[model samples]
Target: MNTIEVKNLNFYYGNFQALKDIGIAFQEKIITALIGPSGCGKSTLLRCLNRMNDLIEGVKISGEVDFKDKNIYSKNIDVVELRRHVGMVFQRPNPFPLSVFDNVVYGLKVHGVTQAFRLEEIVERSLKATGLWDEMKDKLNSIATELPLEQQQRLCMARLVAIEPEVILMDEPCSALDPIATAKIEELMFELKKKYTIVIVTHNMQQAARVSDCCGFMLLGELIEFGTTSKIFTSPDNQKTQDYITGRFG
Candidate 1:
């Protein structure tokens, strides 16, 4: 039931090591939250899964990220294809300036899906999957950025879903939303796990506790502890994890 198995993962930004000897396995069809304080390498590790780090300059990585039995770092691997299967949603709601319909089908369009009927069906399906269809169906041609924050974030997620990704990586997905919007996103995260393996890097401890099936506690650049959400929150095996969860110190 493991979707991703990362072994001895090490990453460097220039000469500074951002991740050190990290090893972890993410379960399939569940939400795994990586929680830590700011600048703790949680986001760096999340980006490594789908090779987003490749876009950064002066970066080096050494590890085996076996995703669906294929080494993601293999020389012949196609990053675009890899990213198509492993989608990402950023901290902020970054909808394209295009219409809601365009935003939803943008991925499909980029991948050469141009049939009008198929595109329309995908837009409806993806939007409905993310709970945006009912609200935005009438305003399909409206500008994406003009929507509310919650709808915008959901639209971003709907866009990802349109491509039928197997895994979704979210970096502080609810950070920019208000309380109500955050709650809606959290609910959406819960629903998404049934179909896609979700990995989320979140600073919000309560949100992590509520949405994730499993949790990993990171410190500095290492995974201090990882286990079921109940166990991690109630009785962590490591003192660092306990201290972090108890608010003694992050």
Candidate 2:
């Protein structure tokens, strides 16, 4: 079933339109990769899903974003809860200055989960799910930022899972990691899709090929083509998609 559906979506930052009549649906518990050149509205659209763009000045969104059959942009929708349901992992690892355990449990606390036992359970489960528990379990009270960038990124993922979100949005998550680290994260994404639908914005074609079930090509604020990853890379219907996949200018 489709977990997220966008219809005729439009976005603008100041006078410049960043997304134009974009529409797509993300199936539940699957990986959808957004591929495009820089400034192609991939990240902008991703941010819109969780209303992260609302934080930027002069940002405006129009049309519908249906998440699990509910319009997330409706006036009555709780923005905080919407974000909690659709968690995000940024390109950079952004662990808080506090202890690793505290960072993982931050979202639950923010949403009024006050029980220490429950918080510990969530942190343990989340860290174990993200494959960070064995390494960090003993060091839960240590500053998380002190970890390497790759571990920090996994920690960020663990933090997102701690909130028990329905969808996980990643914006160029491997952009800052080394090749080995990137491979590990890609493998982790395959494992994660069993529980959470994933939307990832990636500049690396190989990474998308490796991790995505579906791929969408965007250009200059427009979604030009979307289909199964094999079809997109093997025999794209759109000329632009073909060019981009063939190492021509994106």
Candidate with best TM-score: 1
Q: List, residue by residue over 29-138, the lDDT tens digit for candidate 2.
A: 99999999999999999999999998999888899999999999999999988898999999999999889999999999998998989999999999999999999999
Against the reference, the lDDT scores of all candidates come to 0.94, 0.94
lDDT of model 1 at residue 66? 90
- Candidate 1 per-residue lDDT, tens place, 45-110, comes to 999999999999999999899999889998989999999999999998999999999999999999
RMSD of 1: 0.7
Model 1: CA > 4 A from native: none
| TM-score, every prediction | 0.98, 0.98
Candidate 1 collision pairs: none
